[model samples]
Target: MKFEIGEIVRFRKKHPCGDDRWEILRTGMDFKVKCLGCERVIMLSRPKFEKSVKEKVEVKE
Candidate 1:
């Protein structure tokens, strides 16, 4: 699973806002993700993100 910055992914779990969509802000050991539904930002580790992500919608160049 290859991920890049600015990509959108749908996580297996829904956020409190009831949305599973997230936009990738940063990638590496840690990732900066912004929730599409609530416009909230969260920092998550790579392993955690990988485990949470159910599908990658878009890949940034």
Candidate 2:
């Protein structure tokens, strides 16, 4: 469940915008994530965020 800021992540559930992908903005007790489809920002608790995460997308250098 290790992740970093600026990493792209997928959730088990799709967003209202119909995208399941998100970009990690901030990490800690709460995670700040941005929706890739709608460009909306949201904050989710660590436990909630971790449970919903499907996978982390590899970022290219």
Candidate 3:
């Protein structure tokens, strides 16, 4: 559940744009994520985001 800025992650669900990859833009009570394929930004609650994220592409640093 711990991730850093500039990290990439894949979500458990596919976006409407048909992509699963996302980059972490910011993290806090809410997370800011951008779709890797379409570069769309979305803000989600921490728990919701944690559930949506399938894997982290970059290790926490």
Assess every candidate by TM-score. Answer: 0.93, 0.92, 0.90
Q: For residues 1-61, could you state the per-residue lDDT of candidate 3 as single tens digits?
A: 5788899899998999999989999999999999988898999999999999889877657
Report the lDDT tens digits of candidate 2 across residue range 1-61.
7878999999999999999999999999999999999999999999999999998886624
Model 1 C-alpha RMSD to native: 1.0
Full ranking by TM-score: 1, 2, 3
Flag regions of model 1 displaced more than 4 Å. none
lDDT of each residue in 1-61, candidate 1, tens digit only: 9888889999999999999999999989999999999999999998999999999887776
lDDT for model 3 comes to: 0.90
Task: Give the least accurate 10-residue stretch of model 2, judged by summed lDDT.
Answer: 52-61
Score residue 16 of candidate 1 by CA lDDT.
Answer: 99
The model with the greatest lDDT is 1
Instruction: Kindly report which residue stretches of model 2 are placed more than 4 angstroms away from their true locations once superposed.
Output: none
